[model samples]
Target chain A: MKKLTLVLTMLTLSISISFAQEVQIHGFISQGGLYSTEYSYIAENSKDFSLDLQEIGINFQTDVSDKLHLGIQLLSRDVGVYGEGRVTVDWAYGDYYISDALKLAFGRVKNRLGLYTTIQDFDFLRTWAVLPTAIYDLGLRTVNATLDGVQIHGNLDTKLAGNLDYAITYGKLNLGRTSDIAAYAGQLTTYAVEAATTKYNLGVNAVYNTPLDGLRLNGTYLRTEQFAFDPIHQTLDLTQAGMGVLNFDYHIETDIDNIYAGAQYLFNKLEITAEYNMGTRHVKEYITGLNQTVLDMIGKGKPELSDEKYYGGYLGATYRLNQNIGVGGYYQIYMRNDDLDDEDPRKSTSDIALSLAYNIGYNMVIKLEGHFVNGLGPLSVSLNDELTGDLSDLEETWMYGVAKISYNF
Target chain B: MKTKLLPILLLLVFASAFAGEIMVANTVNPEMSAADVEKIFLGKTKKWSDGTNVIITTLKGGAVHEAFLTTFVKKQPMQFDNYWKQLVFTGQGKMPNSFATEEEMLTFISANKGAVGYVSDARAGSLPGNVKAITIK
Candidate 1:
C-alpha cells in the first residue's frame, strides 16, 4: 500500500510537471564505514570494520503558483539494523502562502523538534558524520524526524527584538511493517514485539534570529504518542519460580513529552552550538494469564504503569582551517533515568567525540570521527553483544570510529 | 584635455576597484533595507511589504554572488546553498532561480512581478526602465 501510494504520487507529480509547471530535482548519496570496541556498537561484533551505513535520497520541489508550492523527498538508508535499505517518503507536503505571517502546509511534514531533527540525512551540511547521539538517537529516526499531518508556520519581525520563525504541527505516526521502534523494543526484551498505534502527535517550534549576526536562539516542545504491542512471541517459561514453566500474554502502551532548547553562534571561521532536551515517558502494561499472580507473589509486585524521564544534551564547536579542512567536537551525555544514582552503570551514557572533515570540492565531503563512550544508556548489560546468547561479558568504557564520504547536487 | 582626463581616469580606476559590490535590484521597489534583503533571500520574508509574493533570483556563482550572499545572508557560499537545499528538500520553501549571467538575471527580474535579485554595480548603470536599482539603507 505504501508503494502504491508512492507510485500514484509520483505519477501525479509527473503529469503536473508535464502539463503545468517546472519541477526541480536534487539528491545526495553517502556511505560510511564503522568499527567499534567491546560491544556490538554497529556491527554483529566489536573490533571489526562494518560498512553498514549508507543513504541515498532524491527530492522534488515545484511552485505551482505564486502562492502555492509542492515538494517531496524519497529516501533510503541502511544503518546497521534500522532502515534496512527500504525507500520511504521522507516528506511530502503542499504549502499555501496566505501571507507573510502565515502559511498552511499539509501532508508528511518535517518536524522542527531541535536544531538537527530535519537534517538527519544531510551529511554534507555539517562536519559530523552523525549528530550527537545523546539526544538525536539514530534508532528513533523513523518517527521523530517527520509527521503525517498539518502545520502552520510563519515569520514575525519585531523591529528591536529581531525575527521569529515559528511552526506548530499536529499529526499521526506512520507505523509500518518494519520500524525502528519494534527493533528497539526487541532489544530491551527477548521477544518478537510489533508496534501498533493510531495516536496523534503535536509539536511547536520557534527560532529567534538575534540582532547579532551569526547567532540564533531556538525553543521547541513536542507531545508524541505511539507504541502498543501485543503478546510476545510466547509467554515467559517460569519453571525456576515454582510455576511449572507457565505462560502469559501482556500488552504495553506508551506516551512521550519532549522539550528542547538550543542556540547556535557562527562567527568567521568558528561555529559553536549547544542544546539540551528532556524526554518524559509514561508506560502501562497489562498482563493476562494465571502466572502473573505468581509473579506478583515473588516480590516483583511493581506497579503496572509508571512515568520515567530521560535527558541529554551536547556542546560542540566547529572551525574551518580553510575551505578544504574543518574540525569539530562535542561533549554529550544521556541519562536514561535521571533519578538513578550518578554512579550506576544503567543510569546514563556519555561520549566525547572529535571529528575532522575535508571537502573534495563544492559537491563532496569526507569526514572521520571517533567517539569515546561510557555506559550503555538504557541497554541491558545482559544483552548478547554478539547476538549469540551470553550478554554477561561487557565493558563500561568503549570507543568507536566512523569514516564517511558523501556527495550531493 | 590632459588635466581634465587624468582625474576622470583616476576616478574611473577607483570606481572600477569598488564596482565588485552587488546592488539589490527589483521592479517592485527602488530602495530597501539591507535587513529586508537578508530576510527576503533567506525565504523568511515570503511576501513584500505590499503583499505581493517576493520572487528571488540569483547569479549561478561568481565573485558578485559570493559578495552579496556573504555580506547579507552572513553565510559562506556553500553554506548558503546548503541552507536553501535543506529547506527545499524538507518541503519548507522553493529554491531561488539562478542564472549564469547578470544580464539574464536582470531580464528575469524585469519580466517577473516583485522579482528581487543582486547584480554587479557595473550592470546597474544600464538597468531597464521597469527595473530599479535598490539603495541599501
Candidate 2:
C-alpha cells in the first residue's frame, strides 16, 4: 500500500513538470563548527567540538502563469558520522491562485513556525551566526521540516493591509528509534505487543504574520500525537525472573503548543531584531504489572512525570560598517521547568549563547560565537554507566568559540 | 576656514553636476504604457509583434542605469543590485548589453529589428531617424 501511494505521487509530479512553463533550481551549503559543553544524548555533560555540514536545496518558480506554481528541495547533513542523516523533500508544494488577494497550496511546505523557518532560504540577509535554539528547537517539537497537507495564504495590497496565512496537515512522522539507555531502561517490553508495535503519527499546525512598517510580528500554534512502544512485564529482576508479557493497551498522547512574536527594523546602517517564545508538552499513558515484584518496581521510584512548560527569548543587532565589513551579535536564553517537585537531575535548565559575524564579501561570511549553558536536565543524561538512574556530575557551565566560512552558488 | 570650505564644497557640487538623466526608447510603438515598456525591458514580453527577439542595451552598473531603475522599479539601489545578482547567479536570465554613449545606444537599437534602448531625451534624435520616447513613469 505504501509503495502504491508513493508511485502515484511521483506520477502526478512528473506530469506537472512536463507541462510546466519554467522550472528553476536554487540551493546553498553552510558548514560550521558547533563547540558545546553538551553534545549528544550521552555526552550531555561533557564539552566537545563537532562540525555540522548543512545544505538547503531549493526549487523555485521562474515563470508566472495561470496563477499556479510548484517547488521542492532535498537536503543532507553530517555525511560521515554515525548520526549522519538526510531529510529529502524539505519542501514541495503547489500554489493555487484563488485571486489577487488569496492563494492556497497542497503537499509539503515550510511550517512558518517562526521567523527563521520562513526565511531560512535568505541566509545572507540574516544577522545571526545560527538561529536561536529557543525558537527553532522548541517550535520544531511537533513536526519535521515540512508536513504533507494543505495551506492557505493571502496578502492585502494596502499600506495597513492585513495579511493572513494558515496550514493544517495530517501525516505520519518517523522520529526513528531511541538508543538512549535511560529511555530504553524505562521501556516495559512485552512479548505479546512487542511484535505488534507500529510507528505512526498525526499533527496540525497554524501560523500568523502581520507586518507593521519595517517590522513583522508572528504567532504560531501546533498539536500532535505519536505512537510510542511501552513495555509491561509480569516482574522486574536483574537475572532471575520469568513471566508472561503483554503490550499495554495505551497510546502516548503528545501536545505541542507555542506562541512566537518578533520584529525586524532597518536603520541607516544598522538593523535590529528580537522575539519571544513560550510552550509546554504533555504525555499521558497507563501501565500495569501482574506480580508483586513487578508492581513494586513499576509503582515505586517512578519519576514524578507531568506536563513540562518552558519560556525562551533572544535579542540581536547588526551594523554595516561598510558594504564589505559588517558586525553583529545576539543573546539567546532558554529555560525549562519539568514541574517535578523532587530534585531530579532533570530539573529546570538554562542556555545562553552570543555571536558576532562579518561579511567578507557578497558570497563569504566569517563568524565567532560562544555559548554558556547552566542547569542541566535529564535530556543531558549520560548512558555510559551500567546502572544509570540520574547523573549528578554534569558540568554547569561550558564555554567555547568557533569560526565559520560560507559561500553561496 | 570658511573661504577654504566654500571652495571645496563648490568643487564637489560642480564635479557632480554632470550626473546626466535617463530616458526609455520607443522603437516599435510610441504609445506603450510604462508597465508594458518595463515588461519589454525585463525580458518578460520576449518579442515584438513582428516576431523578433527584444534586445535591451544599457550601461552595466552605472549611475544613469541606476537612476532609471530607481525611478521606474521602486527598488532601493542595493536591492536592485541583489535582484540582478540572483538572476544571473541562478542562470535564469542575462545581464543587459552595455554601451558608452547615446549614439552607441541609438546605433544598436536602429540596427536590430526588435532592439530597444534608452538615452537622455535631449539626445533622442541625434542618430539617423526620428526616434520615439517611451513613457517610463
Candidate 3:
C-alpha cells in the first residue's frame, strides 16, 4: 500500500509537468452500503453494513499534436481485493481522419465489447447498481480492463437519404497472468486463498443503432475465448493396480466461447433495454496421483472429474420524470450448471437481483437494490470443502437492500 | 400545480417579451450535418476538421434550452440524465463545461474558436466578431 501511494504521487508529479500542456482531469468517487434480512442465504443474520469507497479514478488526457491524443487512467478499484491500483493507458494513439466514413486509431483503445463496457467510464448508462455483473465477469476488455491494440471505430452518417447509422470495432483480448486475493468481514485471516492463473484469449464485437422517426433501436453481439494454461486430467487407484486414468486435461487447449445480444428502445419519456448472454466453460480437473486421504474423500467418485456450463441475462427500464430527474428499475438473473454426481449439492442454481435508481443531478445519483435467490442446490458446511453436499431443505430465498451514491468530477 | 404553472407562464411571458436571437457556426472547410451537430453537442465529436479540439458549452439547467434539445436535436433532455448516467456508469465522456446564462454562453463561444453553443434565437444578430450562428432549421 505504501509503495502504491508513493508511485502514484511521483507519477502525478511527472504527468502534471510533461503532459500538463493539455491535460484534462476527470473522475468520480462512489460509496455505498448493503444490508440484508434473513432472506439472504449467505447472510442469514442481519449485520451492520458499512459503505466502502468503490472506485476513485483520475484520467489525464493530452493532445500531443494535431493527429494524436493520449489518455491514462489511474483507478483505485475494490474488486474483492481491498484496493487495487489499476492503471490503464486507456487511449494513447493517433486518429487520422481519412474521410467522414473512415478513421483509424493506433494505440490502446476500448474494443466496444458491449453498448456500455467500452465507456464503462460513466456510472449511469445502465439500470444495475453497477454494470451487469455477468458482462463484467465474462466479457473481455482490451488488455484486461482496456485493450492494447489498434482499431478503426467510428459512426457512418450520410446526408443522401435512407442510409443507416452504425458504430463498429475489432480488437485482441487480454491473455495475461491474473493474481489477486480478497477478504471480507467475519474473517480473521487476510489472505484466504490465492489464484495464480493465466489464459489465452481472442475476441470481436459490434453494435448497431437505428432510429426511425421518434424511436431508436440498438443491438449488439460479442464473442471471446479463454484457454487456461494447464491441461486437465484425472487418475484413479485400485487395490492391485492402484493407478487408473481418464485424461480430460487434453481439452484444456480449447477456449470457452461467450456470446451475447441486446436490444434497447427509447421513446419520448420511456426507455427499455434487454440483454442475453451465453457461454461454454470446460472445467479441467487434473488428478494424476492421489493419496488415501484424497481417495477416501472422493469415495470412488469416478476419478473426481466433471464439467459444467453457465448462462444469464438482464432486463431494465427507465422513465424520465423531467429533464434533470428520472426513475428506473431492473432485474438480472444468472444460472450455473454444475454437472456433477447426484450426491453433489452444488448443482445448477439460479440467482436473481432487482434494482431501482434516480438521477438526482449531472453527477449525483441514488440507487436502491435487492436480491432474490432460490433453488440454490447446495451449501458447504466449511468454506474449503471440495465435496459439496446438499443442505436439508436447502431451497431458500433471501433479500437485501443497497443504497449507492456517486459523483463525477 | 396551479401555482407552479403560474410562475412558469409568467417566466415564459417575460422571456418572450425580451426574446433574442442565437447564432451558431462550424470550422471553415467542412460541412456539419444535423447528426454531426448532435454528436458534437453530445461530446462524441472530439476533433474539428482543422485538427482543433471541439469544446461544447451549454447553459447549466433549465426548460428553454431543454426544449431546444428536444426539438432540434430530437433527443430527450432527459438524455442528459442518460448522459451523466453513461459517464458515471461506463466512464466514457465527461459533462461539458457550463455557463450560467445565455450571455455567458455567447461570451465563451466567442472566445473559443472550436466552441459551439446556443442562446435565444432572437439575439442572433448581435454576436461578436469571432462568433457566428449557424442555422439550426
Candidate 4:
C-alpha cells in the first residue's frame, strides 16, 4: 500500500504540473437506476429499482512537443457484479505524429474495433443511456475496450473518393478473474476459475468519409486467441446427467474472428446509424484424464468443442428537438447458432428500445430509456446467475427501464 | 406598417451581430479555400500548402465562434467539443488552442505564421498589419 500511495502522489503531482503548462483535464460522472419487469437485466431481481449502475472517469492529456502527445484516463464504475467502483487505468498512451498522413501510438490504447466500441463508456457522447446490447454488450466490455501495445493510424485524402481514415493495432489484453466474461464462464464449471489471458490481438478499421456531407461508411476486422485455466475440470462432467462433476488441471483454448460493417448519416436534425457484426469461435479443451467412455458420452471423438457462429446488428435513428432534447429508437436482433438450426427459438434473440434525452445544461444530461426483449438471449444467460438450466426454463420475453443522469466537463 | 417592420429590423440586427469571417496570419499564403479552412480546423489538414505546420485557434465562447462553427465547421460547440474529445481519447488527434476572447485569438494569430482563426466581421477592419481576413469561397 505504500507503493500505491506513492504512485498516487506522483500522478497527482504530474497532473498539477501539466496543468501549469497546456494540459487538458476532462471528466464525467454518471448515475442511473435499472428496473426489470420479469427477470434481471444487470443485477439481481428485486421489487424496487436497483441503483447499482454508475460510472466516473477522468482524462488527462498534454503535448510533450509539437508532434508528441500523452494521455491517460482513470475510470471507476459499478454495474451489477462487475466494476464495483474499482479505479482502473482505462487508457494511457503516447502518440507521435510521423507526418501529415501517418501517426503511431504506444502503451495501453483504446481498441478500434467497431463504430461504438472506442467510445463505449462515454455516455455523454451518445443519445442513449446505454448503447445497443447486441453489439456493445456489457459482458464483453473489457475484452473489447483496450489493448496494451501499439497502433498506427492516419488519413488518406483523394480527389474523387474524399477522405479515408484507417487504423491498425496489435496488442495483448488481460482479463481479470472478476471480469464479466470470466464470471460467466466460471458458472459453466464447478472449479474456481482464474482470469483468461490472450496470446495476441490484431485489428484493422477503415472509414470512408464520402463527399456527401454527414455520411460515412466503415469496416472493421479483428482476430484474437485466448487461453483460460480450468485447473480442476476437463469439461462440465455430464456423468450425472447435467449434475456435472469436475476433474483437475485442464486448459481451454479459444480462437475468435470478428467482422463489422457500419454506416452513419446525418440530415438536418435527424441521425441514422446501422451496423452488422459476425463472429466465429473455435474451442479446444485439453484434459489430463479422458477415457473413451467420456468421449463417447459427450459425442466427441476428441476433447474439442463444436464451432460457434453468431451474427447481430441494429438499425437506429435519433431526432433532435431543438438543442436540449432528443428522441431515438432502435430494433436489434442476434442469432447464436452452434447447432445450425434456425427453427430453434433458443438460437434467436431480438430487442426494441426507445430513449429520450434532455440536456439539463451544457455539461449535464438526463436520459430515460426502455427496452423490450424477446427470446432467451445471451444477456439472459450471462446476467442471471440463478438460471442453472437450459433455455427451456428461461423467460422468453421481458422488459426493462432505466433512468440515467450524467455530468461532463 | 412601422410596428411590423420593427421586428424584422430587430431580427436582421440580431443576425448581423453574429456574422463573422475567417482570418489567418498574413505570412500564410493567400490561396486558402473554404474547404481548406474546414479541413485545417477539423485536423484533417495538418500543414499549409507550403508544407509548414498549421496552427488552429478558437475563441471559447462568442457570437463569432458560434457563427464560425455553424457556417464553416458545420457543428455546434458541444458537438465540436465531443468530436475532439473522441479523437483525443482515442489517440487520433489533439484539441486546438482556444482563447477566451477575440483579442487573445487575434494576438496569437498575429504572432504565429501559420495560425488560423475567426473574428466578427465588424472587427475585421481593426486587424493589425500581421493578420488579414480570408474570404471564404
Candidate 5:
C-alpha cells in the first residue's frame, strides 16, 4: 500500500473563527485516490491505489472601498513530482470597480481560458472528478492557470444580442522552473531549465448570456510572444576525429496561440456543454555549443520548426437526480499533432468519463469517477518521471479511476 | 441517450414543483425591472443608481430560499450558491450575508445602509420600518 499522505486536513485552526465572521476568509481541502490499470497517468505510483492526489487552499479577501477589493489565495498540492506539497501563491489581485461596464485588476490574475479554467480549484463545484484531460492537461495547468500583470473586465448589456461579460488580460504566464511547461521546453534540448518566462501575452474571453433563460455561449483567445527557457549547465559530448569533449548549451524559445469556443445550457437540473480548443505552438531551437565548422557539418537546418497545430473538443452533460445526488459524463476527442492522422496512436487520444457525486450537505461532497482512455496523450510521456525514459513502448488503451472527498466553508 | 435523457427531462418537468411567492425588498427600494432583479442577486450589479454600495442578504437553504432562487432570480438554488462561491473565491464578488431565517435576513436588511433581500409573501404582510419591498417591472 502506498503511503497515505495525511488524508484529513484541517486548515482552519490558525484562522480566528470569530474574526472570520467579519472578515472574508474561505478554504477547501480534498484527498483523492488514483488507480490505473496499466500505464501511470499522473503519479508514478498510480499503477496501484495512490494517495498522491490531494489539494488544500485558503484565501483571504477584503474590500478597501466600494470601488476597490483585494484578495490573495495560497494553495498546496502533491501530484507526482510536480507540486510535492509546496505552497505557492495561487492568485492575488486588487480589483477596482470603475463601473458596471469596466473594472480593472492588477497582480496575478486567473487566466480566463474556457468554461473551466477560471474555476479549476474548488473541486466540489465541478461535476467531474478530473477535468477533461485533453483540454485541461495537468502538465500544462501551470501555463494556463494564472498570468502576472493587469486585467480589465466587466459586463455589457445589449438589448438585442444578450448580456456580454468580457475580460482582457495582458501579462506573462507564471511558469515555475519545474512546471511541465518549462520542463517540456527543456526536453527539446535534452537539458534542464533553471528559469523561464513568457515575453508578452494578451488574452481575451467573452461570454454572451443569451436571452434564452438557460443558454450561454463563450469564446476565448490567447496570443503569446516568444517564451524564453534558460537551461541548466549542460554538456553535449560529440564523437569526431579531433574533438575531445565539447562544453556547450542550447537556447530554446517557443510561441503559442490559442482559441476556444463553447456553449452551455443549464436547464433546471440538466446541464449540457460543448467546447473545442485549437492552437499552434511554434518552437525555435538553437544549438549554441558547436563551432561554425561543426555546425555546418551537422546540418543544423532552419532554427525555426514549423508550427504544430493541435485541436480537441468535448461534449458533456450533468444531471442532478435531486439536490444531493448527481451523475455526469463527457466524450472527448483530442489530437496532439493535427498534421498527423488518427492512425498515429501516440499523437491521438479519445476518452469517455462517467462520474457519480453525492453531497452530504452544502459543505461536503464525495465523488467516484472512471475514465476510459485510448492513446498516449494523457500519459504525458515527455513529462512524467516514470514515463519519460520509455517513450518507445506504450499501451494504446488504458483506464483509471478516482475517488475523492472534499469540504469547504 | 434516451435512457440518460429520461431523468433530465423528468427533472426539468418537475422543476416547477418549487413554488411560492416572495417579495424582493431593499433599503434603497428603487424601481427596477426583472432583469435588474436577476443581476442584483447575481452580484453583477454591485451598486444602486444613487451610487451606494449594494449589500445583499439571503436565507441559508430552505423551501423559501429555493423558491426565491427559482421564482425571482431564475436560477437553481445550488447553481446560485455555486455562482457566488466561484465569484467569492476568484475575488470578483463577495457572498451575500446569509441567515437561517427570514427574520434574520429582514434584520440584516434593516441594519445595513443599502441592503437588499427577499422574504416569503406570508411575511411580506408586516414590514420593518426601514425595509420596503420593491416592485419588479
Candidate 6:
C-alpha cells in the first residue's frame, strides 16, 4: 500500500509540473456505513454497523491536439474484502475525434454496458448512496466496470428522430479468485483455488433521445467468455501399485450473455427511471488424465451444469423538494431462475429502498437510505464467501440501512 | 391585500434582477439561431457553420449564469455541471471554460475566436466592439 501511494504521488507531481498548461484534474471521495438487522448486505458480519464501504478516485485529462486527448483515473475502494482499499488504475485511454459525429478511443475504457456502469464510481452524480444493486451489482465491478481495448462511440443527429448516441466496445475482462463470480464458482469445487481469467468481452450500447423533451430510451448487450482454475490435493490409495498421494488441477469455463433496456424521463424537479436486465451463465468443468475411479466419483451423480438465468429490474422515482433536498424510492426484484421451477424457492428476491439526499453545497452531498429485502436469490453470495450445499440454509428476508457523505471537485 | 401584493412585488424584483443576454465574439458568424446557441452550449454542436471549432465559456455562478442556463440550456446549474462532467470523464467531450465574473468571460471571448458566452443586461451595456450581444431568437 505504501508503494502504491508513492507511485500515485509521484505521478501526480510529474503531471502537475510537466503538463500544468492545460490539464484538468477532477476527483471524488465517499465514505459510508451499512447496518443490517438479520443479514449482511455488503460485509460478511455486519449485523451491526460496518464502515467498510468507501471510494476515492482522481482523474486527469489533457488535450494533445485539437482532436486528440488523453485521460487517466486512479481509484481505491473498500467494499467488504473485495476492494480492500487497494489502489488500482481504473481507466487510462486516448480519444481521437474524427468528427463531431464519430470518435475512437483505445486503452482501458469504462464499460459501456448499462446506463450507470460508466458513472457508478461518481457518487456525486447520482442521488442514491448505492445504485440499484439488482442491475449494478457492486460485487461484479471487476468484471463489468472496464475493458482493456478499443471503443467507437459517437452521436448521430437526425431531423425526424432527434439524436441517437451509441458505443461499441471489444476487449477482454480481468477476473480473479476474489471476484464475486470466481468466488461463487470456487465454492462449488473441492480444492484451493487460483485467480480466474476471461477470454474476451464484447458489448454495444445505444441511447435514443426522442423528440419528446425530458425522455430518453436505451439498450445494451454484452457477452463474455470466462475460465477459472482450481488446484486439488488428495491421497490416492493405489495399494496394488504402491502409489501414495497425488495432486491435480481442474478448471471450469463459463459463457455469459447480458442484456439490458432502460428509460429515463426528467421533467421539472421530478426524475423517474426504470431498467431491466437479464443474464445467462453456463459453466462446464474439464478434468483430463485423471484415474477412472476418481473421474467417476467426480462426475457420476452431479447434475449436468444448467444455464443459470438471472432476471432483475428496478423502477425508481426521485423528486426534488428544493435545490438542496431530494427524496426517492425504488422497488426492485430479481429472479435467478426466471423459469420459475417450483422446487427452488430461493430463486427469487425482492426489495424496496427509500432515500433522502441533502446537498450541502455544489460539491458535497449526504444521503440516508433504508432497504427491506425478501429472499436471498443472487445476493446470497454476500452472506458468506462459501455457498452451503442447500439454498434452504440461507436467511429468506432481511433489512439494511446506509448513510453516506460524498464530496467532489 | 398588502400581503398578497408584497409577494408579487418581490417576484417582479427577482425577475428584473436576473435579466441577462447571450453574447458572442465578433469572430462568430452572427447567423446563429436560438436552437444553434443551445446546441453549442450543450456540447452537441461542436463547430460553427463555417466549420471552425466553437469555444464555449460561462460564468461559474451568479444570477446571470443561472438565468442563462434556465433560459437557453434549460437545465439547472448542478444539472449542467453534472452533464459536462459526465461527458468529460467518459471521454466523450471536454468541459467548457468557466469564469468567475462577466469581465473575465468577456475578456476570454473577445480574445479567442469562435467564442460564445453570456452576461447580465447591465453588464452588456458597456461591452466592447469586439463582443456583441446576440438575440436569443
Q: TM-score winner among the candidates?
A: 5
Worst 10 residues of 1 chain B by lDDT: B5-14
- In model 5, the Cα lDDT at residue A226 comes to 81
List of clashing residue pairs for candidate 4: A231-A249, A232-A247
Arranged by DockQ with the best first, the candidates are 5, 1, 6, 4, 3, 2
Residue-level lDDT of model 3, residues A1-409, one tens digit each, is: 3433444455456456657455667766766675654322222222345353265666765545544544456665543223333553334334454443555655445555445555554454544565554454411322234444555655555444322334344444433323222222112122232221234233444444444534433344433344333333434444455544423222232245666677667677777777777777554433434554554656643343444566666777777675455566666665545454544344444445566667666667777777654444322223222223435444355455667777766
Could you estimate the TM-score for every candidate?
0.87, 0.63, 0.71, 0.85, 0.88, 0.86
Docking class of 4: acceptable
- Residue A83 lDDT (model 2): 19
Q: Runs in model 6 with CA error above 4 Å?
A: A1-20, A176-194, A227-244, A289-305, A339-345, A381-395, B1-20, B23-27, B33-35, B49-51, B91-94, B133-137
TM-scores, chain A, per candidate? 0.88, 0.72, 0.68, 0.87, 0.88, 0.88
- CAPRI level of candidate 3: incorrect
Candidate 6 has which clashing residue pairs, if any? none
lDDT by residue (tens digit), candidate 2, A66-110: 445555555443311211444444455666665534557666545
Q: Could you tell me which 10 consecutive residues in candidate 6 chain A have the lowest summed lDDT?
A: A178-187
- Using DockQ as the measure, the top candidate is 5
lDDT of 5 at A324: 94
Better of 2 and 5 by lDDT: 5
* Candidate 1 backbone collisions, by pair: none
| Chain A TM value for model 1 | 0.88
What interface RMSD does each of the candidate structures achieve?
1.4, 7.4, 4.3, 2.2, 0.9, 1.8
True contacts kept of each: 0.62, 0.00, 0.28, 0.28, 0.56, 0.26
Give residue A276's lDDT in candidate 1 (0 to 100).
Answer: 94
Q: Write the per-residue lDDT of candidate 1 for residues B17-48, one digit (tens) a residue.
A: 23455554443444566677778889888875
Worst 10 residues of 4 chain A by lDDT: A1-10
Residue B18's lDDT in candidate 6? 34
Tens-digit per-residue lDDT, B6-98, candidate 6: 111000011223355545543435355444555678887776655556778888988788877776666777778888988776655668999
User: Among all windows of ten consecutive residues in candidate 2 chain B, which has the lowest summed lDDT?
Assistant: B6-15
Residue range A1-409, candidate 4, lDDT tens digits: 2433444455456556667557877788999899987666676652268898888998788777667777778888787656777887777777788876798988777887778899888787878887887788776787789887899988887845668888899998766644555555643455566577788999999988888877889899999877454345444556567546746457677789999999988775677999999998877775666566665765654677857788889999988786789899999998866464664555788989999999986789899999888865655454565455654665678888989999987
Going through the candidates in order, what is the number of backbone clashes in each?
Answer: 0, 3, 35, 2, 0, 0
Better of 3 and 5 by DockQ: 5
